[model samples]
Target chain A: MKATHIQLAHGNGGRLMRELLETLVFPALGCREAFTDASPLASDKRIPLMASDSFTVQPLEFPGGNIGSLAVHGTLNDLAVSGAEPAALTLNLIIEEGFALDTLRRLLESAGAAARAAGVPIIGGDTKVVPRGQGSGLVIASTGLGWRDAGCALDIRSVQPGDAVLVSGPLGDHGASVLMAREAFGLSSGLQSDASCVLELAHAVRDLPGLRFMRDPTRGGLASVLHEILQASGCGCELNEAVIPLRPEVSGVCQLLGFNPLQLACEGRIVAIVAVESANEVLARWQALPEGQSATRIGHLTVDRRVILRTPLGGQRYLDELAEDPLPRIC
Target chain B: MKATHIQLAHGNGGRLMRELLETLVFPALGCREAFTDASPLASDKRIPLMASDSFTVQPLEFPGGNIGSLAVHGTLNDLAVSGAEPAALTLNLIIEEGFALDTLRRLLESAGAAARAAGVPIIGGDTKVVPRGQGSGLVIASTGLGWRDAGCALDIRSVQPGDAVLVSGPLGDHGASVLMAREAFGLSSGLQSDASCVLELAHAVRDLPGLRFMRDPTRGGLASVLHEILQASGCGCELNEAVIPLRPEVSGVCQLLGFNPLQLACEGRIVAIVAVESANEVLARWQALPEGQSATRIGHLTVDRRVILRTPLGGQRYLDELAEDPLPRIC
Candidate 1:
């Protein structure tokens, strides 16, 4: 009889572990190499870039994506935003013993599909199982290797006064959707998480000569990314609140929950800084893509080192870095 | 006034997370980059090699090392045994909310020390916090990028019948020592884990003209590595029980627990297959290193596809791939 749940033996690095990898892991990840210590990465001439992230989203599976897809997108997005084309990825799964095998398979398949869609292969991986109660159902850590395009330079230091700020899509959907899924507040929403690869959004503006920097607003959302920009460039940001895209469902939940949408996570959104001269071109390119249909120019860099939001009422408010934990394990 | 334990806020990608990284993680890991989405890998001409591993060792701290050091050694050793020179590493830390910050500091410092000792830089990383009870103290997933040696052509396909099998040091110390630390069975011992980088041993034999393959006998110990070799090369291993190196403490623990030392884990050891003519040369080189003083020729590859163990009494028994879990999270 096949075990329906993971056992301690499945991580013993013996027959069961081998069987698990060969039967489920390898096939799901599209890996052809038999178990080996390490894999040889294809040699490339472009400068190499690297990024890593860990996904601990609660409930494992959310509306539009699960921890597996989030893990892939999260790491790959980091590389993408850095103006690099992802070349390969390495995954590490820490599974809790007694977790359902069916669920594990589903997550692995999602991860594989995400990687395939991104055109990046997961070439190496490791699996370890913890005692049942010692771990959440599962946590995936991913590392991405990419090749930086020649002649492209993206750095926070490049941001100067008057640089424009743009976002790829709606904010707070991921965080709000996850919170809704948890049902801690007895609220339900039709909103789906925006967890997805932002590679296309990145590629759309990567060649813009006036592009200064790009970042994916994740855990701490757009507000946090703006704070990073302020710290890095010694410049302030002035945002038009009415222009920042936010879904009605997300805003409704945030208002009820007293959470700031700007401070909430957006797994699939990109916040970019471009010179005023090239902002329209960047916006046009992004708005043409399905992932960036709602892309908008939200604000611009200021000489002063403060993040300010121009409300619809014509009042200005300082946007501070997030301090409290609004929701845990949203991504 | 200060929280001595980790909080969910520390992983929120906000002020708390920034302070945590600046005050604890960055300094401990010798990271200087202020939080960027990704890092740039130094361009190199050598072929890149990638490997990843997660460490969930129980007790968090064991006799010779903690999870932090173990994570570094485990991932680096994977690359080393694959004939790659250590280069850079990425770390993903998943801390249980309420875990002691002091303990986390010690582990991070140990990880930094290990990387420094191995001359590898941890260039990129991420941190996530899980709800307290949903996690063991902490789990570290590390991915390593390395440069393969210029002329090294190591692969299992090169292994042939009559090849000499060698081990760099005693087996099961890591697993037994961790078991002792757990004190789950009220048993104690002075055994210390042999968890360290095997790069020196790998480098010593990598240039040999007849070297067929090299592997780190880690999670499944020497026996499992032999099984992998058997499966990959269509060859079997014939080991002389008396000739294999074993520590008295480890053997004592295994005997008391009815565990096969051969099936236990070794955090830092090498199992290599070399041409019979070059075995003595490889042994000499390994024995010269302090880490490999106990290096021994434990076995030879056999044409018959059956792993056999020759006992001191001139009788033999088949050493099957491990089927049961003797311990969990030893690595």
Candidate 2:
């Protein structure tokens, strides 16, 4: 069904967002490859990739990272998960008039530090300002460009029913942290966001022939990413709720707020589908890295065309794609 | 001096904008080439170029184009003026929640038409939405990627004192049209924006040995572009008041508002510095295109370090970089 007016859910990285893009935005552009995280620039040798994203989170600064750092990590992670080494990025900022210059400086510094950490250069950018009260302080949109390695081709079509699903670390910390940071929740802990790029993880598993696909669950969190893979690969997933990694604080927050942790955002996590034979090796390599110490096998692709979750109590429940936004502007 | 807060002028594409970039952004990235319209991507055989621009025009729709077309033209024009052949573009839209779906459809259609006209593809993009009252209806950020031909290396450093200044068409129409559309100045006529991509003009002059530099006068308009060229080339400019083209309606609006037409924005215009020997040929070639029928020679670079305007009354006036925003969110 066509929407007469946009809803907040349209940006929630869920069903409404996908429907909106497929209906109003994607068909107009006539570029089908854009459905993926990044598009491959046509080349004779290496496959060049590019992706763009706009960050709009209330209270620009959040635990573990801010909008600027998120911008860099988000764009670079998109390229990294697409099997590309981020070479350069463009930062486009829309600051509200009367926004503190010091805040801008701090944000840019954070972005620069993140870029340095990731070994990528911010090669070009544009800055614009809206009148005060028209924006939520600042919005940063970053575009990343990179190139994939030779003989490292990965796609959803390569996945099979037996492929193993692995997550690099805990999920939903970013979403939960941002949620707590905004609106007074009064339930605060030492939990922080997981907002970092996983280039190291990509590097560790890039040469593996069994790696079928990789994605960073940001918006609709882990559930959305799994659903997307199912849609693309025409397969299903069977996840073990007992094995899924979730921080205690994050879980507490989700339980209190009545939010499913699987539907929350994770800025610095990687969801990889690998051949069952090489899953152990990939998990071992990931566990060796500091960013992936919590790497574990959470599930495997199934022949049934539905995502099933097996709870710790040995009960099975279907995890459908979310239709409503649990949190707005969480990323 | 450092600004404690971001001023509207800082995003005006004028003096303050340059200061903000040089002081905080450029140094952080450590990529000096980003100071240009597009940065050269590291490649073995050819220099691939990328440019990004964010459109935050008020009213969403204007006389000549909407935010969508402006986003496409603004980005591609940056690449075109940088001596790159238009290749692919990425669209990032941040729409206000509750924005009309039909309006978005219209805007996307406009953008698709513009991309088709330029023979470029919209390859990849991202979409985000802000709550109502937090955005000016819609904002579009577009990133363009292209490549420079082997021999067509153009830069401000190559410009000399004897180079001629040429503009593709009348200036200030876009700024005036948008301004008139925003407020009821009680003075209206058949004025429309000159929003277009100068790819054909760029193509006509790409092979010319004397083409030193090219830029589109968007924010801060024609005068700001001249100031930028002067800053880079360490040269001055002398413009003939009688020869600078301005539409009658635009001139009238400027008169009513006590503004200089040169300080207004032009979405689809080109200010090129070419050697005096090839200036006439370039102008003639531009005149052949429907979009450049008003191509004319307005001035020439001079050894003096100031932009001097020679009036029709035999008096000279200095043109300074705009310090205040005559129109905000003019795109």
Measured against the true structure, the TM-scores of the candidates, in listed sequence, are 0.98, 0.87
Candidate 2 lDDT over residue span B125-194, tens digit each: 6667677677767788899888776577588778999799999999999989999999877867789999
The sequence of per-residue lDDT tens digits that candidate 1 reaches over residues A1-331 is 2888999889889999999898888888777776467887778678887899999999799999999999999999999999999999999989999989889989999999999999999998888989889999999999998989667779988899999999989998999999899877778767999999999999888988899999999989998899888887799999999998999999999888899999999989899999999999998999999999999999999998899999999999998889979798988
Candidate 1 lDDT, tens digit per residue, B1-331? Answer: 1779999899999999988998999899877776467777777678988899999998899899999999999999999989998788999999999999999999999999999999999998899999889988889999899888667789988999999999999998998999999867887777899989888888887888988898888888887988988888789989999988999998998888888899889999988899999999999999999999999999899999999999999999998888778788888
lDDT of 2 by residue, A219-322 (tens): 77788778777766798999999999999998998888898888788999999999999999999999999998999999999999999999889999998665
Each candidate's interface RMSD: 1.0, 14.2
Worst 10 residues of 1 chain A by lDDT: A28-37
lDDT of 2: 0.77
As for candidate 2, its clashing pairs are none
True contacts kept of each: 0.86, 0.28
Task: Name the weakest run of 10 consecutive residues (lDDT summed) in model 1 chain B.
Answer: B34-43
Evaluate candidate 2 and give its CAPRI docking class based on DockQ: incorrect
